[model samples]
Target: MVQDTRELNRTAVLTELLRIRPASRKQLAAASGISAATVTRAVEQLIAQDLVVEAAELVSVQRGRRAVLLDVVADRSLVVGVDLGASNTRVMLADMVGSPIERREIATPIEADATALADWLASVIDEIAGERRDRVESVYIGLPGAVGRDGSTISNAPNLPQLEEPGFLDSVRARSGRPVRADNDANLALLGEQHFGAARNAPTAVMVTIGAGLGAGLSIDGRILRGSHGVIGEFGQLPAGPLGTRLELMVTGPGIMRLASEAGVHLDSPADLFTPDASEPVRSLRAHFDQALLIVLTAATVSCEPEVIVLGGGIAKSLARDLARYEAMLEHHLGAAPRLTASELGDFAGATGAVVAALHEVYRGLGVDERAFGDLPVAVPASA
Candidate 1:
């Protein structure tokens, strides 16, 4: 093992214990690549700060020996994650261990300007954070459109153009009274799945969403890839036909409805168009959808060869009932398919992912990279 740096010993120890707990100083040292003596000093500091606790004693590897186990105090700090969409907004409060403590939902303040909407969101954060304000670690928000690298600036958004107004992201941060970060909702969806949903532990993955509009999110080597303009996942314009048809026009909710109308039927939703007793033309909607889906899969497989491809959002959930058929479609076209699956977190995936991102951002300097928090489940405390 290398000698601990003058500044990094404590960060390393805490990061290791946060990722995996109930371990002795020896274990922390080994896992964090720090020395035992340094780990002991770091543990003492953490305990003094009430972040880590000496919970129990376990048998040591050495004969007739015992070691004190250190664990993170579950509620020592909390993070807030927000998913602001075109129609609705979801907010979650989670502890340091990524367990969601409480959640709330409401329709988006579409009538208000973007800055005003951000103010409302900040007020919601304040309400939920009430007594825990002092213990709140950070807040991360997910937007329905692309956000600038600064984490607050909105570049372009069709569904919620108001958010594109300058100072929208800054208003949330200023009024929220905590460290804040924000990004595209689709990217957050992929982040949620990689950490807590269908794409768990995958090195590379892609998530495509179908609802009010179409969007995509990508992850490569465990980091969200936003591209030069943070527009990499906007798949609405992806060429879905040989001549020149838009993917959004072929496979999204609107597209499906359009196909139904072309067949002389009015569809309340995709559910109406996909029923068993449907018209022959409406039933043929599947073929068109499959072709557009194939285009998405082919682009993903050929570009980065993702380890998994997850379909999410309202329409994707509706299509999940036929998941096997989609999986088979991938294998048939791409030779070897990235695992395709439905989102496990459902409506909360984006909010949950915001928590995950905020947690990582908190410890990024402590050696817990976004990818390092892999496969760790967000669970409720036994006392709760």
Candidate 2:
């Protein structure tokens, strides 16, 4: 039982470290509720495995020597983060710090070839590598559809039907020569925001992404909430509203076009709904947008009263000026409103989250490379 408890303690400490700042053994122990001696042993194992490293020396006021601070070694591994959105595909290469080193984006057709897409991704990865292609360790993709728990199968995505077929991930991995990780797009968006955006410290938050479809991502007590079958937070299925369709129709590209047409305002795409000019059609579109915002706010807040709610995706840009309107609508419905804000990461949150997950995978895969930490100091201060 003690051995099991110690192993559990190690897992807890590692999670806490990833959530917050890197620390020395003593600090990690305090933050993780683990013993310092056990933390020391864990640190040694982590360092030897190249998962952690001596970051720098912490200065001490006492006459004794300073202690070395431990941190996750980011440069030792790399991963590719891909976002397969409804209308576009974004790819980014990042290290463990979640910093992008190389990034690319391209418009995608509703129906695309999986093989061609995989080959395109492989070429993008090669271009990003330039000369040091071997440095890339793995690939991670955020699918707009529901991802199977195995991280291999894509169940269904209306906008991304090309990926519905099997062996897509296999093909990509086979072409790129690296393991692949796949996740729900909204879930990854929340991960990215949790790690690098406005909700970095929030214990509970919700990210609402509106585009071709309306989806949400939730974090409860700093942990991702993936529901049964790993497809939760799907707000698109909400009851059809005044527009004679689901609330998604109010904001999606097709919805925008449909609504605009009904309003007798001809438009090419939903993106045109946000023209800065104040023509009669534009005014009507803005008014329609306000009503749609209320519908979205009611649906999102009534279900889960999160501490913060962030709106993201292509259509979210138009709502930036109307945050107060949405907040008011939510407050009126729920009787209390979570702090509503626009997403800080814009359209790249999903890609960033994919990379973050991939980084963790690479670190876990390369266990205890003895050559990576030869003779490195691994001491920790008692106070911190």
Candidate 3:
């Protein structure tokens, strides 16, 4: 029990250091709420483990002495985050500080079976890692479907048929020689928002992604609420329309295109919806899209009562100029609604979330309480 207490204190100190690096021992103690002696001890152990380093000392104004500032050893370890979308797969290599060191995107093997997709991912990992592959402590893959309770099986993914195969995740693990973590892409996007974007300090939030298909990621009390079968945010499957069409069929990119075509607009891409000179048919399409979005947001609002709702994905970003109008409509219908905002991380939100998830696993492996580092903002490189 004494050892556990020490470990918790140590984790608290380390977490504070990571959140606000280059801090004096006194600052760390104050920020972490740990005793000065405990902070000193933890800092010493972390320094010895090569996980933390002391930078230039800060000269005290009142005294002649200088205080050392400690920070995490950014390059001591690395992690990989993969966002596997229906059309493309993005891989990011990040240092311990969550700064992207390298990033690449490849066409997703949508037509490939499980084994083929696994092999492709293995090759991509090898290419990205090069000589530093072994330094990768963990890898996280975000899929655009409902991940099973165990985090491997794909219970439902209509866009990516490859995930339906048994042992798909196991095969990826076997090929990569590293345990691969998986989650719904939307869930990862929400995780990304919490760690790196708009929802950083929000206790409860939801991200509704309108891309090739509609999905949501919910955070309740600062924790993701993955349902029993990991389909908690499969909002796309909700029935809508007079003929009982799935909600996604009316709001997603492809759905919008189809609707526009049916209305005689003949839109070639969803981006055309944002064209300045939209035709009458296109105007009708927007109205339909907004109505469908309202249904999804209303359900999310009444059920989760999120503090904020972040909208993401290609279609959402393209129509970002009109989000406020939708928010107002929602308020009119529900009396009060969560603040609606666009995702700052854009398409990279899922990949960033995967990196955060892998970092959490790394903390767990090091016997550190992952919760100790609450609301630590991810360090996104300016170039990335």
TM-score of each: 0.89, 0.79, 0.94
- Model 2 local distance difference test score: 0.71
Q: In what order do the candidates fall by lDDT, top score first?
A: 3, 1, 2
Write candidate 2's Cα lDDT for 162-258 as tens digits.
7777887778778877777788898888777776676666758888888877778877776677755666776676665764666777777767777
Worst 10 residues of 1 by lDDT: 375-384
Stronger candidate by lDDT (2 vs 3):
3
Displacement of residue 90 (Cα, Å) in model 1 is 1.4
Worst 10 contiguous positions by lDDT, candidate 3: 375-384
The residue ranges of model 1 lying beyond 4 angstroms of the native Cα positions read 1-6, 56-65, 239-245, 365-384
Stronger candidate by lDDT (1 vs 2)? 1
Residue range 86-190, candidate 3, lDDT tens digits: 988888888888888888878887888889988998788778988998889999999888898887778667788788788888888999998689999999989
RMSD of each: 3.2, 6.5, 2.0
- The clash count of every prediction, one per candidate, is 0, 1, 0
Candidate 2: which pairs clash? 49-368
Instruction: For residues 1-384, write the lDDT of model 1, one tens digit per residue.
Output: 343463467677776787667788888888988878888888887788787898866656788688878888878878888988788888888888887788888888888987688889899888878799888888988888887766666775777898888888788888887888888888888888887677876869988877767778888887788765677877777765647777877877767787678877777787665576777776677777777877876777776789888888878877767778777887887778777788777777788888888877666634544445664434432221
